[model samples]
Target: MTYSLPRQLSSLLLATSILLWSCESFAPRPPPQRKVIVTGAAGRTGKLVFSSLLKQANFYPMGLVKSEKSAKKIIKDNAECGLENVWICDVTKLDSDNEGSLPNGIRGSDAMIICTSAVPKLRKRHLAKALLKAPINMLAGKKPLDFKTLQFYFAPGQHPEKVDYEGQIAQIDLAKKLGVSHVVLVSSMGGTNPDDFLNTLGKDKDGNGDGDILVWKRKAERYLVESGLQYTIIHPGHLKDTPGGLSELWLDVDDNIMMSPSHHMMSRCDVARLCVASLKVSGGQSSSFDCINIDVPEGTKSRPTEIALIEFLDAETTYDYSTDRKLDYSMNI
Candidate 1:
């Protein structure tokens, strides 16, 4: 004998089965996570980058700090942003000798963003030490005593040549060894020209010129361009402390483009935003460009919508410097 349910009960049972099947078949899947290593993650800019990266559901950011104190602070400050993943490694001291000796923090990293810079106190002492260590005969490379040349030699880890240039090189070497794909370098806007106002600061003072920081930054830029790894070199103008994602961003590849005072400044938060965006745009391809804030006029009838970094990058002409002509001092941007 066949059993028959009441009409109302049978309808309810059939409806429940359909609802369960629909839910099982159409549930959203989580995005794939990608590991990204952030060097100098304890610094002002690095912290913003770390925080911004945390907001992306698919990104797992590992902060690389130079000291245990920094690691502790990062953990304390960003407990919600995966601070337990902070790593300790001095990028300045990373070299071929200790290639395989250090922990494999970079083993599975898909990309790296270098945000390290020498502290002011350390810079002053480092400059003096470099000046005293120079050989009188070869002080200026066969020329008379030129403070700028001395500034370059003594710069490793302490000055622009050392921290910005050499330190970045060490990170690149490690990335290559670990098979990391992309590297995003946070460089200054004046990297292509030593005469730019930003590079001229702290020059020829106390018989110790800082040796155009931009020169060393550009040197590192060139190395990354030639490292055969996908790269994005972001040259942000004078950084300010303003909140990010508020103003419009202006992007240009021409390093010599003369910018007005208002156009020559950007918030560190915005720079960090662009750095993370580059990783997702253009398939993580190599590109270099300058960014600055475009202020909205007060009482304007219509304000421009905040720009998306990926869209801006996609609209610009980005080239692979690795395949371009030999990168020399003459090359701009």
Candidate 2:
């Protein structure tokens, strides 16, 4: 129907106002600010993590070293590189009298990465004896047990039991207390399978024991999941140093496939790159993942830009960083 000029003018004004409002409503948001902390900063992966952070334009890195000496070394290195603010921490507590407890630190981190493990060579019977007697060595004022001495007691068929998982958990608990939001764990690839060689100490489908190694890892991984923080668990395969980068990334938590393609062969520098990439991802929180290195994509020679991990933390929930879910995912060939 035909309308008067004044009526048409009113209609036009209404449409124009609607358009302006819609434009305002659909405006894009700015990127959020992020702070990151990396544990084991003095170790190989930690060093790589530190280097990668230095190259990143946005990341504010907090490096966690184990001892005063390590802290000094990191500080000196950073100062030489014009980097600053590395924190020294103890992620695990061990009896110095007990052999095989290596020193690395964890402190003031937003996310923690446990790249620590031990290879036990002692027979179970012998190890039990040592565990019982090591306390006496200290009481008798004998020289403290060193790794070399501990290795002397290893039996050919027996593997060394790990001692640091509990300590790492304590560090995670501390991080939660300090309000850190994310944790990225560097776990081994075969960890999910009960029968894999890596599943040393844990139970299998038959309820038998391979050893204690896998048991400890599973326990540790489980704790991280229940800790109520955003986490990305990285399960890496057999590692080797390769000349080029990785081509495939396999992620699984089921189907009993223990070993897959390894990104371990890549340089420590590349591992660090991946860890840093995980930290920057918006949706990567509260999830477990696997990382392995492969040849760069065909016809794509340059190293691709790292993808930031996505957070899995539910948007509806407020994070206290102390609560998490036990969830699992698997992708297999």
Candidate 3:
């Protein structure tokens, strides 16, 4: 009786253990973490977005940078907080076999925040001369002053068509191919008008607006909107380096901010936060709007209006280019 009783007890305990194990194994699990890739992640705006993602428990953030050097710098700067992963992908050469290319690791992103833009540099030969004359020209109130005239040009192979248009297109196509569900594009506010003064920054020698960056950026935004993926296009005015929450944020449709005497500026921090928010809202909203950070009093510091920003994800804005008008950029503001 003694041996039989102990054996029966052991058998009963083992059976109960197995039953519990089976139930636990079959229990429902939370959704998998999303791997969100931030292009231009080494830049000021991208850094903030990446940092914010590091704080989020549900999202896994990765960065796609143009060079290994850039990737290293980001890691070094974020030594305390650290990063999950950083991929080196030359967005401009995603389609090229001959140029620096995209890493294969980029194939399965859940969302992409594109902050890459074509950068204009004063033709080195003209850098010194341009630097000397630019301030003088501004001070003199020169009526015909234009930085695009003979001064600046996109570095070889990095023009607007390559970066803003083709680079963005290639990224979008790859993201779509990889089953990405959402995209948040960081673009400019001057695209509503074809003749917007900022387009002059990329003017060709023949005065033809061949390399207009904002035009290319708008084209990329349109492509994302039509790509069937949930998308958010944010056209921020001039970017400021100040803290984000302190500023008053204004959002409008179709370049409405430019209707004022001067385009309002937004902090890189707030734009980054918005980019992160785009992926958090379920079933992303395919919306596009222009936003600017209105300056507030100094020493102002408050938490961001997160609920207001999230509202944008549920309500979409229609971009109407038919209202484009000639914006006079004569103001010093």
Candidate 4:
């Protein structure tokens, strides 16, 4: 073994340097963690969705709210959990509201779940006069409001069609701009069935009719489909605050009503569960299910369904919008 002393030393040093570099630079990267933005975090559904996301260690959930007050309310339940990553975001005014407004902590978020609805305080009269007046026409580039004495519309009142339609579409646009590829929207079950009691209100021209919420929802759903991002629309039935609530979810396209007595009404927890699960399914199908409650799951606790609903949502390549998708189950009280 004739080894040159200087050459052997140089080789040893080079090998040592390479080994150190490997330790510092060649380590495996952590899995891609999704940063979640949960809009309407102040609402009941948003709250539940936030809680479920928090349970998953990988997801860094950020609660997106309209006001600091709403941000505070969400954190009241479990201070540590709520305060972690709460962003102040109002979709109605996304441009100005979200400036430097993302939650302080967390990064690389995957998508946003919008859970808010029109404020209950804004009734038909206010919606007509304040939201749908001529001034809005100037801002929204729409024609004048076409209704006589907004007061005459009661029970099922008239709503601001343009405002809602535009606002929701704008929000979806903003989400895409933020590089969010997956969005989960919490819509209403009646949205699909225009003739159903729940959806009928939207068709009502006057207050006597069901109202205009459904039209807006339908528009939003279509926009989501065209938004070019992976999306899921969860249309839950009547929302209730029940103890140990567990509901069955049925996935379908069109307006077919399928209610099996075996499945009880769904709980907020289940809805939240489904929302999170949608993200896991491949091809974004797990992210776009049109879900509704009909029956209850008798023995289950407040757990989520393992079956990914997004698959069904994406499978409906056709545009037929008749028949209600039904879920049948009985609630275990």
Tens-digit per-residue lDDT, 1-333, candidate 2? 975679789899999999999999899965642456666777766666675676665766666666778777777776433334565445555333333442222224455555555344444564566677877889899754543333222233233233336655765666676567777776565554534544433333453543445445556777788878877666555554443244543333432234443334335555565666667653544656544555556776544425322222233222222221221222110
CA RMSD for every model?
A: 8.7, 15.3, 5.7, 12.6
> Could you tell me how far off, in angstroms, the CA of residue 321 lies in candidate 3 after the best superposition?
5.2
Please report the candidate that would top lDDT against the real structure. Answer: 3
Clashes of each: 2, 40, 0, 36
lDDT of 1 by residue, 1-333 (tens): 999999999999999999999998899878777889899898999999987787778888988888989888887887566444787878888874575655565678898899987543334565676656667647556533344533222333476667877888988898887778999999877655446644544455443555456766777888898889998888888789899877778777656434454558889998898888788764855788888888656764322222355665567676333422333443342
Of 2 and 3, the candidate ranking higher by lDDT: 3
Query: Which regions in candidate 3 have their CA more than 4 angstroms from the true location?
Result: 1-31, 80-84, 95-102, 123-150, 204-210, 261-263, 295-305, 313-316, 321-333
Candidate 3 lDDT over 1-333, as tens digits, reads 344558789999999999999999999988887888788888778888887887777877788887879888878876533544788777766663432355666556788888898887656676566667877887888733455455566777888888898899988886776788888899988787767766766565665544677777877877787789888888888888988777767777887788897548888888987787667653545778888877655777543646646655446557764332232132110
Model 2 ranges with Cα > 4 A deviation = 1-34, 79-84, 94-110, 119-164, 198-211, 241-248, 252-267, 296-333
Instruction: Summarize candidate 4's per-residue lDDT along 1-333 as a digit string, tens digits.
Output: 675669889999999999999998978878766888887777888888887787787777888777888777777765457456787755555542454643344245678787766532324565557454688776778756543323222222214243345556766776776777788888766555444443333333433532456556766777787778877777766566653234456665443433433332456777887777777664444343445554444665422465535445456544343322221111010
Clash total of candidate 2: 40
Which pairs of residues collide in model 3? Answer: none
Q: Which ten residues in a row have the lowest lDDT in candidate 3?
A: 324-333
